[model samples]
Target: MTRSVYVTGVARGDGRQVVELGVMELLTRQVDRVGVYRPLVHDTPDRMVELLRSRYRLVQDPATVYGMGYEEAAALQAEQGQEALTARLVEGYLRVARDYETVLILGSDFAGTNLPAELGVNARLANECGASVVAVIGGRDQSAESVVAEVRNAHHAYTNLGCDVIAMVANRVGQGVAAEAAGALRATLDVPVYVLPEEPTLSAPTVSQIVDTLGARVLLGDEAGLARDALDFVIGGAMLPTFLPALTPGCVVVTPGDRADLIVGAMAAHSAGAPPIAGVLLTLDEKPPPHVLALAARLAPGTPVLAVPTLTFPTATELFTLDGKLGAGTPRKAETALGVFETHVDTAELTGRLSVARSERVTPMMFEHALIERARADRRRIVLPEGTEERILRAAEVLLRRGVCDLTLLGEPDAIRKKAGDLGISLDHESVQMIDPQTSPLRERFAERYARLRAHRGVSYELAYDVVADVSYFGTLMVEQGLADGMVSGAVHSTAATIRPAFEIIKTRPGAAIVSSVFFMCLADKVLVYGDCAVNPDPDAEQLADIAVQAAGTAARFGVEPRVAMLSYSTGTSGTGADVDKVRAATGLVRERRPDLMVEGPIQYDAAVSPSVAATKLPDSEVAGRATVLVFPDLNTGNNTYKAVQRSAGAVAVGPVLQGLRKPVNDLSRGALVQDIVNTVAITAIQAQGGDGDRPDAGGDGQERTEGGAA
Candidate 1:
C-alpha cells in the first residue's frame, strides 16, 4: 500500500497553501515519484495543483488530479447521499495512489460549495483513504490562547473521526505571537505543532495578477516586472513633490491619464534606483501621449504601465482586494513562501514524524534543497568579493531572503547599493553587511597582517597596503582574520586571482599536501564528485594520490560515500600507457594512505559509471561501477570531462570547491549564474562549519555536493 498524507484546514483563510507547499517540498526532498490529488476543486482551474506540477516537475496528467468539481460533488452528495460521494472520491484517489510511491491528498477549500460539514467530510475521506492527517488552523487576527485552543480542537476533531493526526500547523499568525502560539500548543498537545507568521510578500498581489483582475492593458514592462509583488499602492492625485515621498519600494502607482508629470517623475525615481515601485496603474482607461509614455519607458525599461477602464476609487478597491497566489507564474512568491515556512517550522522534526523512508536516488533538486537547509542550520558568515557584480548582488538577495547565511559583501558600499537598487534588489536587511575594501578601518590591520605574512617574499608595508585593497585579497584576509567564516569569489576575476589570496593567507591544512578542487556533478539521478577539475595541471603520482584522499574527505564531508575511482583511458589490465601507469600508481598510493577507503583505478569512464559496462569489463571489483568519487589524472581531462558532462548530460555542476585549505575558500566560473553563486556560497559556508566529518543523514544514498556551472 502507498503511504499517503492528507492536508486539510479547519476553516477558510487558513493559508494552508503554505503548509501544503512546504509539505510538497519536504516530500520531493525525500522521494522523486510523489503524486498530488485534490479531492474537490472549484469550477475554475486549480492554482495550487498547477504550482505543484510545475515546481516539482510532476508528470501526472492534469485530468486525473481531481476527483470531481465542487458543484458536482455537492449535487451528488445531496442526491445520492454521502457514502456514494465518498466512494467516488476514494476511487479517484486510488487511481492516482496506485501509480506513485507516495501521494499527497489536498483537501477541499471551504469556498463556493454547498457540501455540508466540510471538515467532517475531509476527516472521513482521510480515514477511508488510510492517510495520515496534517491539520491546519487559521490564526489570522487570533490571540495565542485562541490559536492554541483552535489547534487542540482541530486535533481532537480529526482524532475522534478515526484520523491519524500526525501534526498541527497554526499558519498566518501575528508576527510576535508565533512563538507564543507554538509554545502553548506544544505544552498542551503531544503532536508537533508549527506556527508560520503572516508574510506580506506572499499575500501581496503581483502586477500581472492586477492586470488579469482589472482587465488592464499593459503598455510597458517585461515578464519580470509583471511578476513583482505590489506590496502597497500609491494613489497619485497629488503633485510630484507630495507624491514622490509617498512612493515606496514595490508599490504600484495609480493615477489618471492626464498626470504625465507624476508618471514621468515616478519612472525617473525608479530609474534612479531609490524606492523602486512595482509598476504604474493608470485609471479611467487613460494613457499619456505616445511621446510622454515613450519617455517613461526610456526612464524605466522594465517597469510596468497599465491602463484600466475603471476610475481611481473602484480600481483601488479592486486592487486592495486582490491577493497574490502561489502558481506557475509567480516563482519568487514560492521562494518567499518556502523561506517563511522553513524559517518558522521545525522541518526536521516534522519530516521525522511523517516516517517517510529516504529514497536512494538523489535528484538535482533534492541536492540543492539539502544544500540550502544544511547551510541554514548552522548559519555561517561568507564574504563575496565581487559585490558590485549583478549576479552576485542578485544571489545575495536570494541568500538573505532565504535566511541561508550571514553575508559580508566586499566592495565600495555606495556602488554596491546603487547597483542593487538599479536592479530592484533590496540589501537593507540586517543579515547583509557591506564593506568598502579601500576605505574600511580594517584595511590598515589587514595590510599589517598581509605584510607580516608575506614579509619573507616582500619587503614593504606600503606594497602590502596596496595589495590588500584588492577585493579578493580583502575578502580572503577577512576569512583569515576570523572576520568572515568563508569566501566565494571569481565571478568576474580569474580562478588564480580568487584562490591565490587563500594560498598566501589561509594556507593549506596541517596534514594536507596541496589545495585541490572538486565539482559536484549533479546528474538526473545522483551526484558524483569530480576531483582536480579546476586546480593542479598535470599533477605527479604523489599529488594525484593526495588529491584523491582530499577529494574523498571532501565527498564524505558533504554526504557522498567516498568510493574513489582513479580514471584513466583504459580499464583494468586491458591497456598500458604512461597515463594509465600514473593512475595505477596513484591508486596504490591511495590504498596505502587510506586503507579503509574503497578505491579503484585505471578504470574507464564507462566502467566506472555504467553497471552494464562494469559487468563486461571488471565484474568482481566493488568500486568499479559504484564509485561516487572520480579523481581525474590531470586538470586537462578533469576540466574537459566535467564541462562535457555538464553540457551533454544537462548536469548542474556546482563547484570548483577548493579542498585541503585551512579555511574554506571557493571560486566560481566567470559566467556563473545567480543560482550558481548562491550554491557556491552555501557550499563555502558548509565547509567553514567543519572540514572532514559525516554530515547528518539527510539526503540520499551518496553525499551530495555542488559547483557553479551551466546545467
Candidate 2:
C-alpha cells in the first residue's frame, strides 16, 4: 500500500513549504522511491513540484503530479457540485500511488481561489485519497491564545471530516509566543503539535526576490550578494553618522539613490563587520552619480546595491508584504529551513506516525546523505590545518553552505584571506573561524603541554615550541584542548606529517592496541567497508583479530550491518599455507571472544560477496558471499585490492578514515579534492559524536580495541 501524507495549510501565508521540504527530506532518508501529487496547482507549472523533483531526485512525471489547475478545479467544483472535482483528484492520486512506495500529496494554497470553504475542501480531498493530514496553521500575526485555538480547531475540523489528522503545525509565530502557543496546543490536543518559531532568514526577502518583485535595477553587486537575506528594513532619512549605527547584520538599507554619503557609509560598515547589511535599496529610482557609484564598488565590491522606483514610504509598505520562498536559487534558505524544522519538529515521531517502512538496502547516496544529516544534527567543530589551500577553503564554503559543521581554519589570516579572495571564494562569513597558529595566545600553553606529554620521549621545551608553531600540531592541540571537536589535514602534506601529531599527542584510546583505517567503497548499488588498507603494513593473529573486531564496530557505526569476511587465497579447507594459518587463527580468536559477530575466515574473494560463489563453496555459512565487511590478511594485499576495485569499478572510496583515537583526528590524502575534504570532515564529526573512541586500559584492560569495522 502507498502511504500518503497531505501537507495543507489552514490559511494563506502559512509558510507550509518549509514543512513540505522537511518532510520530503525525511521521506528520502527512509524510503528509496517517493512521489509527489498536487491536487490543485498554479496554472504555470507548479514551482514547488519542480523544486521537489530536482532536490529529491523524484522520478514522477510532472504531468502526473498535479490533478488540475486552481481555476479549472474551482469551475468544475462549482458546476458539477464538488463530486466531479473529488473524483478527478482521486484518479490522479491513484496513478501516483501505483508507482511509488510513498506519496507526498501537496494540498492547495488557501489563497487565489474562488472555491468556498478551502479547509473543508482540503479535508475532503485528504479523506478521499486515504491519506493522513499534517495541517499547517499560520501564526504570523496571531496571539498565543489565538494560535492555539486555531490549531485545535483545525485538527477537529480535519478529523470531523473523516481525515486522519496525524500532526498539527503552528508555523511563523512571533519569537516570544511560539513556545507558549505550542505548549498550550499540546496540552489540549491529542496529536503531535509542532511549533516553529519565526526565522527572520526564512521570512526575509532576498535581494533577487526583492529585485524581481519590485522591478529594481542592480547597479553594483554579485550573484552571491543578491542571494543575501534582507532581515530588517531601516529607512535612511537621517544623516550618515546617525544612520550608520542603525544598520544591523542582514538588514537592508532603504534610502534615496542620491544619498551618496549614506550609501558609502553603509558599505564601509559592512566591510568593517559592524553589522553587515544584506544590501542597500535606493528609492525614487535615483542612482548614485558615476564617481560616487565607482567609489561604492571599491568599498564593498560584492555587496548588493539596488535601486527601486517607489519612494521610501511606499517601498517600506511593499517590503512588509514580501516573504521568502523556497526555490531552486535559494539553497541557503533551504538549509536554514531544514535546520529550523529539524531542531523544532520531532521528525522521528512524525515518520513513525506516517508509517513509512525503512529501507533494507543502504545505497551509496543514502550513506552520503546520512553522513551530512547526522553531522548537522549535533553540529561539531572541526578544524582544517591546511587553511591556505584553495581546496580546503572551497570545501569549507560548501560545508558552511550546507550547515554540515562549524569550521575553524588554521593558517596566517592574511594569507588565507588573500588566497580565498584570489580563488573567488568568500570566507568573510561568520561561520568560518580563522586563526594564525604562530600568533595565537594558546601557542605557549600548547607548547608547554606538548613538552610535558613528550618529556619521557626526550623532548625539550624549545623543541616543543618549534613544533607547536606547525599547523598540523597546532590543529591537533586544538582538538586535545576541546577548542574543536575534530581535525582534518594532509591535502598538501604527507600522511605521516598529518598522523604523526595525532599519534604523538592524542595517542591511542584506552584499551586500543593500535590505530587502523577504513575506506567506504561506495559502489553503484551499495556501500562496502574495507579496513586496515591504509595504516597497517602487517599483522599477526592478535592484531589481525583486533583489526577485524574494530572493522566490524566501524561498519556498525555507519549504517552497514557487519558480516565480516577474513580474506585469503584459500576457501575453508581447500588450501593450506602460512598466511592461511594466520587467517584461520584470527577467525578462531574472533569467534571465541565476540561470539555475537558474524565472521568467516580462510575465504577467497569470489566467495565472500557473490551469493552464487558462496552456494557452490560454503552454502551453509552466514558470512560467505554476502559479506558487508572485508578484512584483508596483510597491508600489501588490502591496499592493492581496494585500489584495484576503486579504479576498475569506478567506486568512490571515501576514506582511510582513521579509527581508535581518543578524539577524532582524521588524515586526508595529499591529493585530496574539495569533496574529499568535505567527506573526511563529516566522517570526523560523526566519529567525534560517537563519544571517545574505545581506549586501552593499563595492565590488561579487557575491553576490545578494534580500529575499523567492515560490514
Estimated TM-score for each candidate: 0.93, 0.84
Off by over 4 Å in 1: 43-45, 457-459, 692-711
Task: Tell me the tens digit of each residue's lDDT in model 1 across 1-711.
Answer: 688899998788888999999999998889878999999998545999999999898989888899999999999999999999999999999999889878999998897677899999999999999899999998989998999989999999999989999899999899888888887888898888888898988889988999898889999988767877898999999989898999988899999988999999999888776677888999988879999999998898878999998899988988898877888888777878888888988899889877788889988888988899899999999999999998898898788878899999988787786566555567878898999988999989999999987887874789999999999999988887778888999899988888778778777766677778999999999999999899788888998999999999888888889899999999989889899999999999999999999999889998998889999999999998899999999888999999999999999999999887777889999989988999999998889787532122211122112222221
Q: Each model's C-alpha lDDT?
A: 0.87, 0.84
Best by TM-score: 1
| Candidate with best lDDT | 1
Clashing pairs in 1: 559-703, 560-703, 653-707, 654-706, 654-707, 654-708, 655-707, 655-708
